[model samples]
Target: MSATEEAMNRRIVLARRPEGEPGVEDFRLEAGPVPEPGPGEMLCRTLYLSVDPYMRGRMNAGPSYAPSVGLGDVMVGGSVSRVLASRLEGYVPGDLVAGFNGWQDYALSDGTRIRRVDPELAPPPAFLGALGMTGLTAYVGLFDIADPQPGETVAVAAAAGAVGSMVVQLATLRGCRVVAIAGSPAKCGYLREVLGADVALDYHDPNFPETLEAACPQGIDVYFENVGGAVFEAVLPLLNIGARVPVCGQIAHYNDSGNPLPGPDSLPRLMMWVLGRRLRMQGFIVGDHLDRLPDFVREMGGWLREGRIRHYEDIVDGLENAPAAFIDMLRGGNLGKRLIRVVPEDAAGA
Candidate 1:
């Protein structure tokens, strides 16, 4: 590579901790030299960057399931990258991989947590969405944790998103009647028409709780909790006896300032429902279930080949726009998996 190319590594770092909703000011984009790989290491050029809701938590100062992103550090994220140079044994130049390359244009990896991606099986970006961690999250959360039976009513929040979209389709394949919830009409249409959800409801409607209850006439047998707060409150009273709730994400509450929400305490009501219905609520981190990845890849791969599943992505161009896209995703502005196209589509294959 030319010296100019090696000097063109651009990165987006956390400029400051967000107060409530994060703004573009919280991130600063800067250019730096792309470092050469040492023995047993590889240099990779990032192609696609994934912007997820969990990243919001990582930006905070408090402790979470993962360590917080330190100020002035490269923001944490996953990426689809191409091996540019390698001294690693198995990896070679031109090989594609999925790994934690963060929000940088180039990164070095010693093969830790890195997986080779076969671009022939699926498009490269799919590795960052349905065929990668996102798909595994849905598979593990729904089948392993929630365990919805055939003919059960399964309600999924954020039903048009990456993980939720997979859960909607997989639940349908399992013979469960799915009631999908989204923030907008367009996303609701995609959930019902494209994803094959039995019923789709717009959560912005004033009567969303009542509408959701009406849709699940038999009561919700399984609730995939993606958005917490009001969405959780709505699903609480509608849970059937022996219901299972897989707490996947709580996007709505991620931006809160840690103060209690102003309202009557609803813990007593939630407790009563849990006690009377014997509901099983479990929160899971996808990293904890990596042992099942091979099985998921095998089955989900076949489903993709047979056209039994379809994945959607909302991609933004350039690394500079990632912060805006991420902030938009956090506010429920995205229709599917939100990704940043670090490399232009025409040149991505190169």
Candidate 2:
């Protein structure tokens, strides 16, 4: 972290807007002088970088809930970092924190939107996963939006993923029968054997629709939607009256080329079912619910301590590999929360 030890900063910047699915060519890695912390700012060396599904939306050039990453700018993301120098109050050199550091080896923060990470609560990398925004996203989406009742059958798409995994566990803890859906048998096994889901279904099965229907004989009372193409098509008809759906992400459609949907138009039928079922569907961005972070941290922290909640991370090493790892993650290649390890946990000044 010393200026004598490191002279340049390495970062990945958006090279171009992706046409459909992003490629490594869309990003460019560059080196520049490491930034200095000015008044009230802290110099942080990146430890871990989170790669998430929502980032796909940010790579586009269209309207979205958040601002798109402009060409030539650092790709937007959250990171776990170690403060190397501090002019900011309450923080000092060698303090680990979680904040927005983008895809870089180092960054400067004015202490805005940064939180102290207690290594005693969990590992530093965990701040980018279970005990961080990923966990908070699941907490807000399930307890605040979906609000599954005891005994209600809750169907979760991508149930083995970072957010979906959290949803499955939280819903199960709420006393709901969880029908966890994943693309692979191994993931489904994790959902069933490890996460305690009532039922687990693999979406790749040819009879997936029928299997899903059979899994929820009473009909799905709550659907935590993460993947939205055929998965939504199958879940729509099975939704019971007054069902609640918290739309978290549509990873299935994130790579669409803006072409028309391949199957027969189902909009009319979807609308009819929506009216007849009185279903409530809400799409939420977790950043808007930051007020709930303290409650989430406290409750989820207890669950982690009691072994009631488990978190898994698929970590890729090096800042240079972030682009490739991100591309692969979009293709359902990651099992849990995917992260890029920028620095070793036991490194000097860490």
* lDDT per model vs. reference: 0.90, 0.90
- Cα lDDT of model 1 by residue, 208-234, tens digit: 999998998899999999888888889
lDDT of candidate 2 at residue 108, scale 0 to 100? 95
Poorly placed runs, candidate 2 (over 4 Å): 1-5, 259-264, 348-350
Residue 240 Cα positional deviation in candidate 2, in Å, after optimal superposition: 0.4
Q: Note the residue pairs that clash in candidate 1.
A: none
Q: Estimated TM-score per prediction?
A: 0.96, 0.96
Rate residue 90 of model 2 by lDDT.
Answer: 89
TM-score, prediction 1: 0.96
